[model samples]
Target: MNMFLINFSMLWSFSFFFIFIYIITIFSIIIYIIPSLKNTINYTKFKKNSNFDYLTGFDLYFLLLTPLILFLILNFSWSSYTISAWFGNIIFSSFQYKIFFFIFFFYSLILTAYCSSFYFHSKEIYDYTITIFNFFFWILFLFSSNTLFTVTFFIEILSTLIFLMLATSTFSTTYFYNNLNLNLHNYFNPTTPFFFIQMLMYFFWISLISSLNLFFFLILFYLKFLTFDWFIFEFIFYFLTSTFTLKDIFFSLFIWFNLLFSIFLKCGLVPFYFWKPIFFKGIPLHALFFYICFFYFFIFLFFIYFLLIYMNEIFFFFLIINLSLLIIGIFILLFIICEAFYLKAFLAISSIINTLFVFLALNSTNFTDFIFF
Candidate 1:
């Protein structure tokens, strides 16, 4: 109880401090904008250019989130972690925070680039709605927690919505299509950038559904196991103990299989992979920069984080499945490279397949998850 209170007080104080700093920064920007953006603000762009002031102001607010994020990271101590905080089981360590930090770092770079480039291209992006969306995406993604519920409730929803708004802003809703039967075209043309990013996010929603379905399968079995008292074997202890029998071993294997496949789907691995080629079209130079540097980097960090958790559940099933995935990933990678007309398509395909290799290496090693930190 005392620890909880201390943590809560710290959290509250930190958040308050962040908010205070952020407010001051906003006022500072207001002063700067009043003088510098005088022309861009009251005239020329929107008939109602005042609309952008608030939006741009909010857009600038994301800058302050960086210091708070870094402070949380700097204060992170792997050995001192508690499973529950004010946010309810949202705090912990192991590969989780390291992976979170890597993800935060990776996404931060892309976001910085995106915001900078977008500001330069702001005159081109005239939609007030898009400005609002751009703000939410940066803020929501920056603050989204690593916990499962937070990821589902915040990141998955906001990320999808963010891209959807971007997608629609760039083209008529009529231009978007499911078009699964359609082979990807325009591999060498840089004309349509959002079209490609939008399609990647479109398939992200589908992959989300598939991952959830498989995740619930594991949950269902988990609930069933609780009736027979399996939590003592699996949850409380980090590893299987001598209290188990052959039957328990097989059940553990089953649970492990569920975990492996669920993560596989989530990371865009084979058997559930479809979005890559569709979005591997020739995008604008800037869009391609963000896509290649940011998108794949985000997914790869996620894959590493997830793989560390379940890689200990070594069974013949895991071995066989991973080997199969590795073979398939390699074949698809080569075929895509040979067939692709553009470098972007090849890069995307190669990055997707490389995630499987990451999984394979982690699974085959006894290096331990903590070593990755």
Candidate 2:
């Protein structure tokens, strides 16, 4: 049985990592080598753009499909082997994992059908689809996370930063194609700075979480503490032991406040809401789509996690805060939505609604089961 238990998450993760390398190699052959191959072989009888166009975005659908299939594979219960060491009931093999993949699979299928839309775009725009697909590969691994929750959390933050960087690259690529420069002298926009700011937020979160993890881990280490035979996860299952001491409580509060503060910034809820409107302004619709789709994906998971963990709490502290966010965020957004004003403003409001809704869900649910509903 021990021999049978290879690290499947690591296996799938490294497999996708290699798949990306393989993909990049194939792209290299198509983009660079194929032209040389055609030129030497006197196959110029074909159209000049045919070789590049044929394969520019051909694999994007499969890239998406691969994860969907991996999800199915993990869930199939081969030899009745189950995923062990998951922090929760839901791991790669769980029914919830299947449901998650099914939803994303449908989304991927929809996006694949829309690849024809890319065909209508300029070669540059069409070619940049690779970045988007590559982005999904790392994100797929978030589901592949194993015993520790930190891996997924860190991967998520890294992926978020990469997505933003890719978005910026796409924007720069677009500008180059259309001969538009967005320098300070010509035009100042939100594209670069928004990603930069978010990256900073993610780094802050990572550093804080790592510090908290290390702090607790060292205490667990130095105290010569053996298993408490008990554990309670307040957030992300990081504490890893029974902790109810005053000092422990204070430390937990410190971690929680920092983590939640960073999240509030990302969600763009009230009082910390200054940056999101400016960030949304003048951004391309495609860029906006990337942000909405990916950011909310993480936010939704966090929402669900919090709902499960906090539902049975004796205190109503977080409940009040979440309710405050929902009310204040929604009422402010109502003014933005009703005004029928700038497109970016509407987009910001629409995007922020996901976060507000999460708050609303958190506020309304008094039980873990309600989270699923």
Candidate 3:
């Protein structure tokens, strides 16, 4: 119990530090924007034709600084743990250095890709701001998730940010096309506004349903066990399962089914996958890259962690789901190969197959087998 408290306190402090940095970044941007705003007003009054750059060097500097700050924090945390470790005891038992390393690697990759893409492409200040905030929320999600509640909360926040990113990208592109009198039909189908709204509605409904399912499971679990911490929940669940009656077993299975279903929806697996291609089609390339590479990868890692905790008890059920996914994935793969023409749709469908393969790998008994797939 004391150790749990210590871990919780450390986690809380780290989360607070990240939030403080985010606040400071936002305030600094606002300060920069004020001067830019005055310049825009002056240009308007003089009828000058100069373009005022909203995304200045200052904005890019702060954007680049975020990942560096995150790297330093993780390094400091890991080194503190390493320096304090002894024969059979550790100061920060809950800190997973491996996960931190993985996060840092992927985050740096994402930052590099984002910077490169924006450097060559036209930029919008709103898109840049949204992307920065998205990264901040993602860092918070990765580091601060300790309970089921926090996981769900962060998922919802990230979903909202993704939606905003997609909407803004679509809006800006449509406006640019309009200003240039370009034929939108050559690039996109069914007009921008209609397709954008349709995509947003589909994404919104899917996210809402997934969140509700997970929240229902969380509420039920909390009512039964009176706690939200992942380790505590696992311990209590194991203890209760040993003595569970047949009815209790079924009830538990139902609860887990909801939880698993929610995960599947979030991961864009099989039946819940229709929205993904549409969602991908409407967003800008960079936004789509982040959604597929960072967002879905995080969701997959989260799903793997949850399954690892409950694998023994849920083995039979998971096996059944795995086989179903395999059969369905193959058929979907064939159909997509035949029907998918657009690049974004092709990428989206391919990601689903890749995710299905990874989930199939989870059924393997050996670690190397899992890695191989």
- State which candidate has the highest lDDT: 3
Best by TM-score: 3
Candidate 3 lDDT score at position 115: 53
lDDT of 2: 0.48
Higher-scoring candidate on lDDT, 1 or 2: 2
**lDDT per residue as tens, model 1, 1-373:** 3556556646754564456447545644454454246555554443344343322433543744565465556547334663433334233445445545665565566556555544322322333233332433333232324444343443344345435544544442222222222334532223454446666665567557755765575465556455322223335224445546767666665665665576556546664454565555423344446445654455454445333443334332335565576677667666666535545556567667666566556655533342353
- Which of the two, 2 or 3, has more TM-score? 3
Residue pairs with colliding backbones in model 2 are: none
lDDT of 3 by residue, 1-373 (tens): 2556457545656665566567656754764465466565663342244354434434455555675577557556653443222211112334545565676678667765565444212345455444644555454344446567767776777777777776666645434343232223344444564445666888888888988898998998787668766666456456546965877766766776787689778668755676776766555666677777777777677667666764544443445565666677677567666436666667888887777677656665643443466
Which sequence of candidate numbers ranks them by TM-score, best first?
A: 3, 2, 1
> lDDT per prediction?
0.48, 0.48, 0.61
Better of 1 and 3 by lDDT: 3
Deviation of model 3 at 289, angstroms:
1.4
Full candidate order by lDDT, most accurate first: 3, 2, 1
The segments of candidate 2 whose C-alpha lies over 4 angstroms from its true place after superposition are 1-77, 84-91, 119-128, 146-153, 156-231, 234-247, 267-271, 309-320, 323-340, 365-373
